[model samples]
Target chain A: MYKLELKRLIKSRSTLFLAAAMLGMSVFFACVTVAGAGSMESRGYITLRGMEAIEYQRGLFAEVEGYVTTERLEEMSDYSVWARDTYGRADNMPRDVYERWISYEPILSGSCGRMSCEADEYYAERRAALARLAPSEAAIASALALNWRVDEPFYWEYGFGGSEAGVNWTLCLFALCLFCTVIAVPAFSQGYSCGADGILRCARLGRGKLARAKILAVYSVCGALYLLSAALFCAVILLTFGPDGSSAQLKLGAFVLLDMSMTGVLALCVLSGLITMLASVSFTLWLSSLLPNGVHVLALSAVMLALPSFVNAYMSYPACDWLRLLLPTGSTGLQIGMYNELAAYRFLTLGPAAIWTPFAALAVPALEAPAFALLARRAYVRHEGA
Target chain B: MNIEIQNLTKKFGKKTAVDSVSLTLTPGVWGLIGANGAGKTTLMRMLVGILTPTSGRVLCDGADTREMGEAWRDMLGYLPQSFGYYPEFSVADYLDYMAALKGLEKKAARRKIAELCEILSLTRVYKNKIKKLSGGTQRRVGIAQAMLNDPRVLILDEPTSGLDPGERVRFRNLLSEFARGRIVLISTHIVSDVEYIAAENAVMKAGRIIDAGTTAELLRAVEGRVFTARIPERELERAESAVRVVSLKNEGGGETLVRYVAEGPLLPGSDFAEPRLEDLYLWLFRDERRQDDV
Candidate 1:
């Protein structure tokens, strides 16, 4: 029965069109991000070969690296006096002269001081939640230590500030969820729309086994779409960017300050994306079974998957911010941010174990997928031909 | 197996579609004859367990349909009044899909599907999509799916509605051949389809069975009430308004032969005519319309 349903799904014109549209969107974004990659004029450290060109500047700013420590933050107060004595506050300085001056010791020291100050303020804002998450505090400190790109200069355009590849991945995953919803929401109601539900319900194995078959078919379609889209997106990014810093720490890039390996961070992104896709499809299937009209299911699913993104972007409640990140449409940056240095919030504690914000976020979909599948099955079996 | 409908009733909001009625179906071809909005489809839907009855239950072998939902369906086959099919599916694929729904094994389903297609004269168009088929051919495919499981209790609603004259005759013959031991209830607008083949005939009006018996018995009930008369062309309207005209024929210049159902002669020179199922149908509904008007 599942095989037959899958065949029917793939053969449907609507499903085919949605699948093609999803792939097209993913390819378009990935291509655009790769083609217009990093600029050679930008200042943040990127690749090993790039560091060769700026070795003289790095040696000149060696004194600022020692002052980036947490204990010496007060000693760094003399950097403003030093900047005034060297490059005076002149109105019209040449662009090249200003750029070279900023690459000196005083400017680098001031930038590191500003980063530390911002970290302290963020920690203060989330003190209560941070008190519970000791490991998260440690991870955040480690991420800060590895955050500066003082040596390496290989520009990975896939990072946050480089070419916006991370944002594209997030958008592609979200669009994939929408496409999977379009494919899944009509599985139970196809018969209803065409006047075949009565006949189907009356068939010997239809009322019971057929419901299970439809659920399996929906999940199978969702999984296939995710795998295909994710693989295509990854191939395009990796091939164009040349996987230079994959083994390097995630902090090696200009954005995404984390204490973990680059591979581990990418894995978490993929895991979160797959979980969100599954949860969204299962929840939409349940909605389909509960409602009578296909349009209602589609509309309600749109609201469910989209409303969370809008709320996450606009709403700012520190106490419940971790909970918001647990939503299926939660921000991808937030997932990385949960593991980044200075992520001091710990919204949950299980006995002696401290569940950090990232793990808490992962726990949501881990529990939601099975629960949604069970509810969808129950709704379908109990459904009458209304 | 036997199906007993005990006090079956169904309602759609303020309108009662199938009223409190009871029926016992055994192994034979039972013809259900009714006009539009006569509740034949509603009763059939209830019997098949697709629509829940407002009161009472349908029992198969002493078990309620609601209690034995899947098991009850396992022994039954039904074709709805408005039969639907996936337009993208070919005739063979549609049959195979239905076979899977009915829990038939693959080898058995293939064999059964092949036999049905051949029996229904659909072998040549087996691979053709249903949307591309003609109305008569599509109806044949509907019939093929209904008989896939060789169900013990088979119900078909308006199975001959789209068939041509020759196809209708062929389908009627096929139904007769398939109804040897299984119980088959066919509801249709074509009276002659039931007049010759069905062992028993039932007539419904306003959600209730007004009359039921063999065709000969129903004809006998309205016997001596049917008459034929000759009238002038100009007076034909007056004759029609006075009573029910079952049929009208144009004789030569200005003369007409009118076969009508009436208790007494409407013309000075009239002859008694034999009553058929059509005559009985017109008389029953015509009488009900008159009462509604009053």
Candidate 2:
């Protein structure tokens, strides 16, 4: 039955078209990103490859540390000279001074050697907030503490620069969600729509085997789409940009990507994306059982997949913080970086608390996939010919 | 096996579709004849175990189908009134897909499908897509799928609905062949389908089985009650309004031959005619026909 269902799925022309379209979209965007990076690199703005990026940052950080002095800060503090030479002009300042100033901002701010009352209060709030974390979240926070990098100079690389990786990973996940929705939206409902559900429900394999086969087929298709799209996107970006940042610290990639290896951040992002894919497929199957028409399921699922991509722009409220993280759309955002933000909650005893946004994002889908699968199975069994 | 329906009833809110329908049968074709809305479909659906009954049970070989679940389903073969097909699939592929759903292994399914294709004379069109096939051919495919597993209990609802007369005859012969050891329940509005093949006839009226017996026994209800007369063509409407006209034929200019079922002859020159399953069905469902006219 599983083999037959797979054959039927592969034979569907529309499904094939949709799969190809998903891959095409990913490849097209990847080519455009690479070309844009090449154009920027030609204009004396060099982007480092993976290992070269790590070596360049290590070299720059060491040089910057040598010049992180009170006298340099005093000179930089001189308004007339600073404004005349380096205020808004990019080419006037020496590269070493600029790198030191940018990379050691935190150290320079605390270099006065006296802790202000405001800083004291901030530390107290951070410690109190850290104490409020769940056991799992606290464990994660402790793990992160063990590998924390104090300060690292940013690496400007072809594929890893600006919002390149964030945008690429985001689109890769969004495309995966689309592929799953298109494939699974019609999974259960097509039987009903085509009027085959009645004959199937009464056959020997109809009771449980048929419904199980459909779900398994849907999962197989979704899993393939995720792997193909992720691999294609990763290959294109890494090949074009050169995999220089694999050994680089997460703090170098983004200000808040803290305490993790760059590769670890990439892996977690992909894992979070895959979790949401599972959740999307399971939820669509459940919805297909409930909805009367297959086309309606398709339409609603497309909306569910697309609407979440825009959620991060408008969603901001303390009350809705947990609600936002638990949504399927929230998982598609740059949750890898968002997990490290400590601005929202603070603990006086334990210092700043690590956010559990990505963990919650992963957990919601991990829990929802099975729950929806059960609901869908019950619906299929209880379904009459009508 | 024996199928015993001990006081089965199914109701949809305020309306009852099958009311206290009961029967016991084994190893023969039992034709359930009824008019539209006479509960033939509801009864068949319940027997197939797809719809839950409002009351009562259907026991196959003393095991209630509701409790037996898949075990009962395995013994059953059903072709619903309107079976759906995947339009893109060829006839062979459609049958193969159904065979998989029926849990037939590839080699066994191929053999069964080959045998049925010969029996149904569907060999030539086996490679044709279902959407392009004629309605009668599609119906034959439905019949072919129902017989795939050689079920112990076969239930067909309006099995001969869309077949041509020639196809209908062929289907009836096939049904007769298949009914040797299995219990076959065929529900249809076409009375001739039951005329030659049905071993026992169950007549449905409203939501109840008003009568059940051999074809000869069922015809006994209208014995000496069916009459034919030569009437003026202008008086056909009056005859139609006043009596149950089973059929009408043009005899000559300004005259018509009217065959009808009634308590007595309406015309003095009317002569008695042999009662058939048609007359029996018309006589049984006359009240609903009158309601339809109103």
Candidate 3:
């Protein structure tokens, strides 16, 4: 039964079309990221862009791919001051000078700032900022404790650009959410829309077992689509930019408090994305079971999936923020999503207790997936045909 | 096997669709005859357990069908009045899907599907999508799905509506052979579809079962009242308005043969005709037909 249900869904032209669109979107975003990649050099006024720039930056960072010791930091700082004094701006420096000096500027700048590079001053300032910005004292303490896990002498590497760009591209996740909505909104409602429910519900196993089969098949299809798209997006980006910074610390590029490598961050992002996709699909299935037809389910699910973006854009109240963060598609929004939440020091406070936004985002959808799936099954089984 | 409908009633807002209807069904081919909106479709839907009744319950073997749940559904088969199918599904795919839902094993399902396809004359179009089939062929597919499980109780609504006379004859034969020891309830306005095959018949009007019995027994009400008379062609319209005209056959030379129902012979040289189930149906739903004409 499950096999037949899966086959039925796969046979749908709309499902096939949307799946192709999703994969195309994934590759398109990857290509866009790669096309936009470029690096500036001052070697007799020669500038590199695209894959050329990426390779140039990769080679420059390869030589410095070790722990950021005091000597390296001082040497970088000395070069930065010399280049600024001589050229007045790095872009005005000679190509050889820019290649030798400024090409390594990103590594130097991120590690040397008070916001990151210096451990004691960074943490102290961070704590004060946390106390000021954190929703509660518990949040401040949580952020401080989590910050301690950031690997000291931050490991510098050359390949994080692709992984970072792939994971942080909000449009990729948004498109995926919409595709999943289009796929799942008709899971149950199609029966009603086509008038098949009257006959199906009369079958021996049609009510409960068929509902279960539909739910499982929809989840399997949508989940596989998500994994495939994410993999393809990562593959395109990583292949273009070269996979060399899998072990590099995220701290080198983003203001993330988690002590995780670039690969670890990518995994977290993908895992959170998969969970959010399932949760959103499950919610749509529940709506499918309740609505009379697929059109209504599609309209309502689309609105729901897009609501968080609008709320985050126009609203600032605590309740509005909570609503934005708690929605099933909350982690896939453009303004506030899993990637942004992971890098920001935001927290959701509940009286004295506080939880990190990334943790809350992952947890909410993880719980909602199974809960909504159960609700969807119940609603389907109990449905009375028109 | 037995299906007992006890005081079943269904209402949509202020309109009553199926009102306090009670009947018991046993193993045999039974016909439910009614006009449009006479509640035959609504009653069939309730018997299939897809629509909940506002009051009362249906019992299968003395146990409430609601409580029987899947166990009761396992013994039942239903073909709705107008059903829809996935446009992508081929006739074979649809039958296989329904077979699986009926809890038939894959091997059994394959065998049953092949047999039903052959029996229903759908073997040639087995691979064709259902949407592309003719209306009569689609109705056969619906019938095939309903009987795939060899259910103990089968309910078909308007099973022969779109079928040609030949196809309708085949369907009637199939149902008669299949219902030897099973309960088959067929609801249709075309009384003749079940007139010959139905072991018993029920007549519905205004959400109630106005009459039910064997064809011979139910015909007793209209017996001796059904008559055939020769009238002038110009008087045909007057005769139709003056009495319940079951049928009108025009003869040569400005003469028309009219079969009608009335208390006594109202026309010159009118002879009493044999009352069939259709005569009883026309007699019971004459008021509904009058309203339809208005």
Candidate 4:
């Protein structure tokens, strides 16, 4: 039975295609990791000169009225009015930048400081659900960026509209899904695509044992690739951009959350990979059993898998919004932002600006695994023969 | 134990494929000869539980095959006219899979695979992918897999269709050896192949077994309905229209030797003669509705 399953798996066109795809993706993943790590330093982000330098500059001034001196207050007041006036400006030096530059002092800002950041755990769940385009993904998702190479930190905090970091994060997700789907589509179509049904159907316990083996083998093959790609990309982004919050920063917006344990993100990858594999295999199995030709299985499964993504195209449409929530790709349609509740900003409370990441990722796979298992059995044994 | 077909009937929508067909087949090689669309494949498929008959009892050693799942199929082996398998797999891998499906334990499976491969001369190509093998070799592989379990009953449909002469003889010899104490119903359109191997020949035409018996017995039954006539080539068509023309051979100008079927003489010297298997098949198949047999 083992031999039969192995033979059936080996003979399958989908399996071979998946193997080749994994190898290529693994290499691409490694490159993405390397590039991300290598380029992390030069990425778009600004680091404050230093608290020491700013503090030294502040020391030169005299203080009064439990605030700064009257003159220092005047200087701070001058900048505050300019920021307020140009709040909606889109200039290179927009108020958004000015806002970040002149945050309040811990005691004087009237907002919570490091002490407030301590309670950030309250909003952490929502923050962890952030989804945005990773810079690496956005860098390649568009045709204008045709010459743009894949970079590191392949994933972003939010999968859709936010800051430059947020947009890239969301786009990156769309890109990765497109890539992962190539592998998943073939895995599902393998049985019919390869014409190995006879061997599978004839084996002892062929209906039951061979199917389990197939699902395992396909998942193992695809999972290995996904891991290699994800790990390599993360390494590249992290290594290239030093560990400072700016380089490969993982900030979340207010309510959309991700991993509090950090392990959640990694678990997400492994889990999604397994789910995609089962869904693909099961769908393919169903197609092979029902359709006379494997091409139909491949074409139809690809369409069915991809059709759900159209919901993300129209952001403002209410129906599209609902559709996106139901789409398998919707979770990744988020954006992440950092709400600095701290004075020096050593820590950031992460959140998705307007999306749900953790939940969507988990839900997509939950719907796919069992569906594929049933389909695989049908495909492996359904007969049109005498 | 024997499989009894009790007035078994199969209807395809409205057209009956097998109608009121009853027979008792025990352990031996039974040759089923019929023309195209004669319900040969349908009958065989039903016997092995692949196709369901409209109303029939496919008993396996007294057990209904439909009612009994694994227990019935455990003893059944079938090879359809066209069978497909994964082409990239080596013959051994495919057989192992078949073994698993047949519920054979690993040890027994290995032993059976080896034995069948040896019998079918598949040992040389046992490790080769099926796609790379020749047509005849592939057919043998199908046969080998069918026999892997040493099944109590085997239904082989057109088993020798793709085989070369030597392989066919070898297959026939092998089947005969195994059929000594097992039921093997081999379906074929060709009469000669089974004429030599079958203990009993079953003739089917228009979805019914018009005649069945030992080779000599069937030949004797059709003796008087068959005859040969030499006449002008143009007039031969007339004789053909009047009688079932089995064969035609041109002897000279405007003259042809024609063998045909008749209830009595159509021409002055058109006497009845001995009938071959082909003649019987034609006489039965010539007109399905016309059952004017003497």
Candidate whose lDDT is highest = 3
Give candidate 2's TM-score.
Answer: 0.83
Which candidate has the top score in TM-score? 3
Q: Interface RMSD (C-alpha) of each candidate?
A: 1.3, 1.3, 0.9, 3.9
Provide TM-scores for the models. Answer: 0.80, 0.83, 0.95, 0.70
Q: Scored by CA lDDT, what does every candidate get?
A: 0.70, 0.70, 0.82, 0.55
In order, the TM-score of chain B in each prediction is 0.95, 0.95, 0.97, 0.84
Q: Which candidate number has the best DockQ?
A: 3
Judged by DockQ cut-offs, the docking class of candidate 1 is medium
Compose the digit string of candidate 3's lDDT tens values, residues A212-289: 999999999999999999999888877877654432332433446776666666667788889999989999999999
TM-score of chain A of 2: 0.69
Runs off by more than 4 Å, candidate 4: A11-14, A26-213, A223-250, A257-263, A315-357, A378-382, B6-22, B53-55, B206-221, B229-242, B247-258, B265-274, B288-294
lDDT by residue (tens digit), candidate 4, A1-386: 44455556556676566556554554454344333321111113333232332332233211211322324334444454465576533233443444332432211122112113322232232122221222222321221232123122212221101122223323343344444444444333444445444433433354556566656654555456556655554454334332222112222322222212123333344455444444544555555556655466657756655554544343545445435434433344223111111101111112322222334345554685566556655655545342
Q: Give the CAPRI rating of model 3.
A: high
Stretches of candidate 2 above 4 Å error? Answer: A38-88, A93-163, A244-259, A306-315, A327-330, A333-355, B289-294
Q: Tell me how far the alpha carbon of residue B102 in candidate 1 is from the true structure, in angstroms, after superposition.
A: 1.4
Candidate 3 local Cα displacement, residue B151, angstroms? 0.7
Instruction: For each candidate, report what fraction of the true interface contacts it reproduces.
Output: 0.66, 0.70, 0.91, 0.36
